[model samples]
Target chain A: MQNDIILEATGLTKEFLGFVAVKDVNLRVRRHSIHALIGPNGAGKTTCFNLLTHFLVPTSGRIRFNGVDITGRSPAAIARMGLVRSFQISAVFPHLTVRDNVRVALQRPLRNSFQFWRSDSMLDRLNDRALALIEAVGLAPYAGLPAVELPYGRKRALEIATTLALEPEMLLLDEPMAGLAHEDIDRIAQLIRKVAADRTVLMVEHNMSVVADLSDTITVLARGEKLAEGPYAEVSKHPQVIEAYVGTGHG
Target chain B: MSTRNVGFLLLAVALVAPWVAYPVFLMTALCFALFACAFNLLIGYAGLMSFGHAMFFGLAGYVCGHAIKVWGWPPELAMLGGALAAGALGVVTGALAIRRQGIYFAMITLAFSQMVYFFCLQAPFTGGEDGLQGIPRSPMLGGLLPVHNDMVLYYVVLAIFLFGFGAIYRIIHSPFGQVLKAIRENEQRAVSLGYNADRYKLVAFILSATLAGLAGSLKAVVMQFATLTDVTAAMSGEVVLMALVGGIGTIFGPVVGAVIIITMQNYLAATGEWVLVIQGVIFVAIVLAFRKGIVGEIADRWRAYSAGSRK
Candidate 1:
């Protein structure tokens, strides 16, 4: 394992009754790099994210973040430690203005949790930071709009901005470009590059082109077990990864 | 109309309404206004449906009644004492009840409130069926002036109602309140945002319950008694009806709902059980035919019209 490792999972396992959703999986994420996890449907990509982020406790295995043993910690605790995940669904307060949504997300890191009486100006600096991020993700035009009224693609972009507001050292993005238009995919792909410049990025994506374009390394899973792990070019040509993709196409 | 402006207008009308009508009726409206507004805090903003608010209300009344009649404390101190006591209960109950979400949360709170009701019925301090009677209102602060004057008491209650309403207004606009709204929309996301969502919800519940306690304690002082009527499940149902009829989520909706219901109760006092049946019909009508209630429907229509015209 590298000394600069940001996230490490060793023998991570999860089971629902008799069914094993994820079993004996090992993942290592380096600091300041985009690592993509690709797999077929129901191949436990999401379950792995859930286990790593503590949204779901592992039936067995261990997760380490920034050298801390965070296997059984709550989601809130893990997030506070700068490990955050963006949802597959847009997770935002639809009734709140977009600016307020990001502002609240930033407020958590400032240690001002109970200062309800302070004016928004106390958060003016944070709001500025959020606005800059919103613009960075191509959402400046919808800054004042309620999140619910935004188009689906825009909402997904907003979710990324909100997650970034948490100031995480590592981001676990679950299918960030799953249902976006091609142009939007290119736009978010660029945004992901800008984000990966300063943070460790581990993403679950089904878009093979995006995986090949963005990932410094790729890990492929089939039936809750690692089939291949290497550079994107290397993994794409690997016999096991190719067979998993092709076999599933025929199966 | 905006909620703050509507709330102010109602306060203006309430302050003077007593001059033309019976003092007791106006006072009754004021108490229920605070009650409804407090209940609205939980339902409207936090997206919590508490069918057990009357537990805080009646529990505060019982505490106030005991302090005044048995402990012989003055009225202001008595009410303050009751508010604090009820706030403590709110924290404990909220801590437990907020563990569940949606309908499960509602059922947990309602079940806990029923236990409180049974405690009141059998508790010696509650005076059972007879309740605590012949309680004194005394004077404000330290009997600085006579409270026997109904007009003076009316102004006192009005001031408290406005203060509570203003507090609710401030909270909903505050960042903490925004987080509560976030939790209501999506708990999983709020948690991932590093918010202790459960702690925020519990705080909201305690604040609402404490204010509801203030209303209940004031009622005990005004009426000079605490009775089983205050603690009954029917009182809980009535407040929920008020929130539903006015608009569950809007700030002023509860006050509007309360005034309407109180006025109806006063005029139809002679109608016997038909009053219960009539109220039920209104609740059903509001839920089935007009899901937005009075204020919500108007707001929705206004938003639609504005959006359409802008296009």
Candidate 2:
């Protein structure tokens, strides 16, 4: 009775031209779970992420988030419904400072996103929250720095901080630990652990250690299809998942 | 100096300028400055490079001309009518153009602009090739103020330009401006943050178009004619040139750009058609020499110099 899944995708499929990119994949992300979607390089994990987040329309599938069908929603509308996705390559607003980047997300809830008539000083109220989120991701020192000037690893942190500012119910991270330094990886892992305390996290992560350490459930995909699903320990030992990774030299 | 002080200084300069310069020329440049500023709001702030903005400016001019000449409307009412008509056009064209990205967006806008131009060419109100001529410079606010005096009209034009420029300045610095910057910088990221990016883009496009219309309305009143030349594709390119030369994103960049380009064209008028050649050369030179634009480059240098001095 306690198992109320937050996101449910059934028969999700996507085709580009004549080739199928993501085929008949079903995924369910539970409430407040650290779910890691893992697979080899050519896996349809990215496509699947796009479909669930409404960044790409599924070729044929129904996606129900919070038990409501959200098949045709715009990405922004989907995000407003509390499902936010971070881009694969850090999606920081390059010209804006770290604080302003977070503020962009915080201002969404204000709904005056187009109050061009009013002065910007009204937005000063959001500064404290923006700064807090900046600090939450250990970006307080670089808070004044333009996001373009931030180091590669720090941009990822800023991206997460911005997503956090939205107070999303579910945060879908596309390759969160992709290009981080070893130290950054651990810190981000800690941050993810902290973030998942109150919200659901469904991340497509390449780092197996982070996957093993953080995920409550792991879903593996290979060649545009779900190969296996379960806890990391159990799925890592699955013959198909092992063959999928080892077969592609991602072992 | 603070932005507030700078704004006041610019205002003082504008007030004093018409006395020193030719009032007609000054008013003309002021109208174009406002036009360029409105254009910059899209390209500079919103990162929407619209190549069809002449549609708004020219359309408003014709509308204002018709209102004043045919309807016998006051200048104030005519200007308002022109700007509102342009704003309405923006709503339609903006909805069509904002969804597209990069070149496609530019093309859509340009196409819409061409459509507007053709409409103006055939529309009985525009007088086709002859243009709407001998338009009277009407009084302001139903005889509250006389604007028939060239000098008085100069001030009126200055006021209109200032209002438009101030509105643009406020928009850029507002919460809405912050969101526009976000959308401009990374649209996908903005959307991911629950921003309806297209809606914001459409709003920005409309604002730009409306302000451009205001500029056109002012120009028609000041010049006493709404010509086919005003609505041409080349006019659209001229605004872009002004913004690029002055400073694409910086306040007062487009004004400076408009002044410089307009002055050059006025002075080079003796060169006949070669004035266009000189403009093209300057545009290319500016583009090549200062990629960040004149104001942007100067600001960068100033920052570096001040930082060095501090050291």
Candidate 3:
């Protein structure tokens, strides 16, 4: 039923200087699900993520989220609608304390964006919630640290905490497990599992083990076209996916 | 110790200093301090370099001058009118200027400000060569205080300066201010996290311009005159120098820069054209050796030494 759709893209196309990055693509993300988008490099996965989240306007096609058409919306508007994205890079206010970073993220949804007239104590309650999110993400110890001063892995955790503060119904994570050490990836995988308990998480991951372990559903693409879609075990054995990954030796 | 403690100490000194210093000189420093602090809002906190801010300053001055002289408006109303007009101008100019980024943004604002300067030059109300002269200083708010008393006017200017400076400090500490700093540090990251960076920038621009206008409007009242010279590119350069010399990002730096520069200007009033040369050298020195300026360098030193001692 249409009610199951959290996000849907129909006939989406993207081009850069006449070079086709995505062509005649269709995708859908179901409600309250962990959907993994896996592909080789230049598979247009990142471009697709950008298009769906309103970071980049599609050349043509329509995107609907939460049963409403969201084409041509600003990223901020889309996010305000409870659709949020964490960047491939650490997307945090590095100069601010971790608690402040989460508070800034929460400020948008709280409609406290321009409350310059209000006293600081009125906002302390918001920081308490931010601290709770920080603790849930195991960042309680680093909560007072400036985002930039924290270790690399901690910054990523802070980014997740900040994103969660937006109270998104759906989260688009771009390479959440990338560049993480094996042990750190396990921790991040556990965090993603915890986050996924409440919200729909659509993540683009290169790590096959993470994709296998966390995803309820997996979609594989090679060269901008859908190769296969299923649970992880089925897709891992798909001939085209195996051929794509085996020959490239990069993903 | 803490900058807040130091700020309070300075505030106390400023409140009591009319006995020791010339009222005119003290008032000039106060006006310049407010102006510098307002200018720092965009550059220091928002990471926006607005080369066209002098347009706001000059426009407000001219508007206040016209309102007082032609419309015969009260002093408070005239200053408010000036600030409102400048805020309106800021909205338009900021929308256009913010379409560009980095050095291009700076150039766009500079170009737009220069347009305001040319408009003032040809506009008939500005009085062209002589400017609006022999302008009367209106009475204090609601005609409560006599206009002719020097120390009373000095205190009024100081109060306004303090109010403006306090507003800036509060804004910087607010959540909105933190987001602005985030946008300044990494705009793409801010966008990815769902902030409308352009909107934040425009709001900051308007706020900065309106406050700068308030400074100019007060200046017109203090000097009891408005001139084309106030809107000139040199005035723009001078405010930037003050911010740079005091500290580009710190709260107290610009005020320090403004006070020091005003003091220098008074002492060098007897010398011909030396103030400009001296200020220019200070700018070079700030950019070259003291990129943090007087306040930033001191703050950095204190932070570093404190951390070191704690360790």
Model 2 docking grade: high
Candidate 1 chain B weakest lDDT stretch, 10 residues: B1-10
lDDT of each residue in B146-242, candidate 1, tens digit only: 8899988888878877788888877777767777888888889999988888888999999999999999998998888988888777898899999
User: Per-residue lDDT for B10 in model 2?
Assistant: 81
Clash pairs (backbone) in predicted model 1: B44-B249
Instruction: Give the per-residue lDDT of model 2 (tens digit) for A57-131.
Output: 888999999989999999988999999999899999999999999998998889887899999899999989999
Q: Give per-residue CA lDDT, model 2, range B249-289, as digits (tens).
A: 99978988999999998889999999999888988999999
Best-to-worst order by TM-score is 2, 1, 3
lDDT of 3 by residue, B1-311 (tens): 89789988998999899999888888878888888999999999899887778899988988988999889898889989998999999999999999998789988888988999999889999887677776687786768977668888888888888888888888887767767888887787677667899998998899899999999888888888888887888888889889999999899999999998989989987886987888788789878988899999999999999999999
Return the top candidate by DockQ: 2
Write down the worst ten-residue block by lDDT for model 2 chain B.
B1-10
| Better candidate number, 2 or 3, judged by DockQ | 2
Local distance difference test, candidate 2:
0.92
Sorting all predicted structures by lDDT, with the top scorer first, yields 2, 1, 3
Residue B188 in model 2: shift from native, Å? 0.4
- Give DockQ: model 2: 0.92
lDDT of 1 at B190: 91
Chain A only: TM-score per candidate: 0.94, 0.97, 0.95
Candidate 3: residue B263 Cα off by (Å): 2.6
